[model samples]
Target: MARPKVPRLSADRIADAAIELIDSGAPFGVNALARSLGVTPSSLYNHIDGRDGIIELVRGRLGRRYLPELPTGTWDEIVVETMQGMRRLYAEHPAIVPLLVGKTITDDAVIESYDVLATALVDGGFPDDEVLSVVAVLDSFALGFGLDYASPDDIWQPGTPTRSLGRLIATAERGDARSDRVFELGLELVLDALRLRLARLRDD
Candidate 1:
């Protein structure tokens, strides 16, 4: 009798497995993943071209889940909503947050989502050249904030257990109003500055 042939895995299946592993806080490595999937490491090549391909697939999945059609609203409202959405998505997939911060936008879905926001800014009288710069600033701030918020106790190192924000705050001397008040004040200041810049550009 002939030996039975193994089933071939599709790229989507491999990507799905990788995502599940990452979301479960497992270290995403080829050897371990191949073992988990009951295939040789070489089998992954039939699915993903390489590690970068895997990263792109993961990013695509994240973008699909998080980057919905943004609502038609004022620029500030859109920014706030986009930031909130990004924060929620990053929190759910903390393992991939670092990848998001360091990697370039390789996934088409991710790129398109960003383009939608940039187009909105351009339509709102912002210059085309500055739209992407503004978006980069806003996205970097949101990602940094989300990472800090999600991993409050982690001592900025890999393989370390994260600390709770409450514990860290308890060490500080209690005196002034909420720290978040300061954050809100700073946000308002930035918005005001942005508005002034827009006004000056329009006047010119």
Candidate 2:
């Protein structure tokens, strides 16, 4: 008798199929994906635990490919470079914007990147606890900007302006400027606010 044929299914392969569906701008529910893969919905369980597992796989890929390696320059340089890298990543994987918005960064690759960034912030004078807060702000801003950029409503808008200062001017004229400058300005404002608070702490 011939040996039974084993179904071809793996976490990576399943993730790839899901990503392809996402790329096509189609819904990526388990049933639709199972149909596309020519496998029963239960077959996916052999590869991934469930929908969350598939989402984790996608998030892992997105983080590894998009998160920038820590920069070796000034703290400001590292911050700017990292933010720019994130912006580019979201631009390339627009379909994954929602995932980026609320996804937890539990993947080792993502955690390592966060560690590097957080370490940089600590070295730049932020308290360890504050580093995570700063990271959260930057990540949120980058994701929000990417979503705005990728929206069909803004597809016809002019490209994001290059110069940071020029962004404010471009936005005033109805052009969608890059959010890096705005983010930087916000960071500065936060730093100023922190400094004031710290001063009060020291005075007390």
Q: Best candidate per TM-score, number?
A: 1
TM-score of each: 0.71, 0.67
Runs off by more than 4 Å, candidate 1: 1-12, 151-190
Tens-place lDDT digits, model 2, residues 20-71 = 8877889877888898899999887777767777777777676666663546
What lDDT does the true structure give each of the candidates?
0.70, 0.68
lDDT per residue, candidate 1, 58-98, as tens digits?
88777777766654677776766676677567756778877
In terms of lDDT, the poorest run of 10 residues in model 2 is 171-180
**Clashes per candidate, residues 3 or more apart or on different chains:** 2, 0
Note each model's CA RMSD in angstroms: 7.3, 6.5
Name the Cα RMSD for model 2.
6.5
Instruction: Output the TM-score of candidate 2.
Output: 0.67
